[model samples]
Target: MDEAAGSPAVSRRIAPQRASLRPWLLLMPLLVFLAAFFLVPLAQVAMMSVTEPEFGFGHYASIATDGFYLRVLADTFATALLVATCCLVLGFPLAYAMAAASPNMAAAMMIVVTMSFWTSFLVRTYAWMVLLGRSGPIAALLDWIGLPHGELLFTRFSSTIAMTHILLPYMVVSLYAVLRKIEPSLLRSAASLGASPTSVLRHVVLPLAAPGVVNGLTLVFVLCLGFYVTPILLGSPREQMVAGVIGQQIEEFLNFGEASALAVVLLASTLIVLGLYHRRFGLDKLWG
Candidate 1:
């Protein structure tokens, strides 16, 4: 009996280690890919940021000392925040509706959202440009409505609208995944306990959905921060974002140092936000 008990305990001890090893084994390929593609590239960029154009911290110093660069950084963060907030506000209702939908309806919605992902992003941006440009259909409609002719294209407003549309699906899908997992009985229980519809939502639904909301917000915010093509196509010079600035430095000025420095700053900012989120809300909760 003693030998049998000891054998069980020994197996228990070995079981967890063996199980852990399996996951690490499964993760080995992903780790190798990340190290090869992401870490190596990132290391190269960091080296270029500090060591190019005669070395030292000149590129970073320019970012700090130049008022125009500082303004662009601020604008980039502002635009990202605005786009995230808009996505949240717009996506929440759609997510709720999707979650409450029947299986067939939800499947249909998923198909539509997935189809959007297959569409070319550049084509979508150009479509927006064609619709919003002066003398385009929207501009013509405004003129016919007795409104003043508006130059909406190539403006910050146009950029924001386009980005919000592009990112809305991400937010919806994130929230939908979490919302679908919630037990319908929980809401029914709240109602049975004399909770009103608004009370049930305010107390039960919102708390349950908090994790998904945070996940979606983080996703949208990070994506918006790194936006390049849409902003370049839709925004004017004054509305240039960090990504646009980085691209110009790399492509037009051939200043890889400054471009990499800007990229590092953007990367650091994103990491800080993610770290704070993980600290405050435990990363495990984000996966539904």
Candidate 2:
């Protein structure tokens, strides 16, 4: 009997090793692709950032000493934070409605959101330009309503609005996925236990939905940091993002070293934020 028991224990120990090997085998192609495409190019960019023009940290030094570069970095973080907050404020209720809707209604809402995604990003940005320009329908409507004539395009407000529009769908989808798993009976139970609707939401629902909120905010913020097209088409020179700065360095200035340096900074900042989010909120909960 001891021998039989020990045999099962040994098998259990070996089973995990076999299972691990299977996943690694399955992931081999992805691993090879990441090494070839992502790792190799990243290493090349890092090398270029440091050694492109006379080496010895000049590219990094420019980022530290130049006020213009520092302002660009600040603006990038500011815009990302603003957009993420806006998405959260606007998306949470929408997600709740979708999650609570009938299957048919939810499916219709999903189709509309998916269609928005399928439209070309460039076309979307340009469309906003046409809608918000001085001679556009929105501008004309405001004038007809006796409002002061305003220039909406090529401003920070337009940039924020366009980014919020583009990113709101992502936020809604993330929240909806998590909200769906929350049992409706839980809310009913809370209400039956003398909890007000507001109290149930404040104490139970918010805590349960936090993981999704964090995930969505992190995703939208990171995407906002890298935004280029909307800002380029609808924003002023002062509203230029880090991506715009990098583009100018490459295209107009022809300064590969500076461009590589900016790209590295952007990459490092994104990874740092992701690391902090993971540390604060065990990323396992995202899947859980």
Candidate 3:
């Protein structure tokens, strides 16, 4: 029998000083795990980015000078911004509807959103492939309607639409959380004070939902920055994003050093976004 267990009441009354150490003690294993797996691997990648194929920052220099790499990096950010904007535009109304619905209606909407989200990511991408392909239903419908079905597959438009669909639930849930927390009386009071519905939403609701907007944008943008399969499969070969370029370097050219460097750049960009958010609003508040 352990002494701590034998004298349960005595253990519960342990000195206050030791209680402070308990949290750290409980966290030790997770710290060790992250240090071993995450920190060690990151360090290795950083070392390889500079040291592989002879040292001396050649990969970094090339990235700075090369037009192709610079263009891809720019395109990556542009696409992420587009995707995040589309998500917010489409999600805000749906989330508002969900919040405004009765309990049963809201519950059903949530279930549908959750089911879509839980469906395999690849499955969603492939479904988009089927829908956007030349012989698919969308093109068929266009043709039937006497409209010219110009090329749709392997276009930026297709990729953006698919990515938006895949990420929409994230924005919806973020907005739904914030919207649900808003007091109904506040909106009623605004109306009673002779404010129009649009005015009430613009002044009161939008102000309250700002945190969720920031959170959804940050979440979607960061996720879009790292998007791999969707862009490669759906986007044009001429327009490549950072993740696709990184994969091409590793798989097609076997340029590990350059790929590692690109990966580091992407990681740094993500960290900068997070840092800006933290500076604006504490990280703890973002999740809430």
Q: Pick the candidate with the highest lDDT.
A: 3
Better of 2 and 3 by TM-score: 3
The TM-scores, one per candidate, come to 0.86, 0.88, 0.91
Rate residue 67 of model 3 by lDDT.
100
Instruction: Find the 10 residues in a row with the least total lDDT in model 3.
Output: 8-17
Query: Which residue pairs in candidate 2 have backbone atoms (N, alpha carbon, C) closer than 3 angstroms, thus clashing?
Result: none
Q: Give candidate 2 misplaced runs (Cα > 4 Å).
A: 1-26, 193-196, 284-288
RMSD of model 3, in Å? Answer: 4.6
lDDT of 3 by residue, 117-207 (tens): 8889899999999999999999999999999867898988999999999988888999999999999999999999999999999999999
Candidate 1, residues 166-247, lDDT tens digits: the string is 9988889889988898899999999999999999889998899888899999888988999999999998779799999999
Count of steric clashes across candidates, in order: 0, 0, 0
lDDT per residue for candidate 2 within 185-231, as digits (tens), equals: 99899999999989988988888888889989998998899998889
Q: Report the number of backbone clashes for model 2.
A: 0
**lDDT of each model, Cα atoms only?**
0.90, 0.90, 0.92
Question: Which 10 successive residues of model 2 have the least lDDT summed?
Answer: 279-288
The best candidate in terms of TM-score? 3
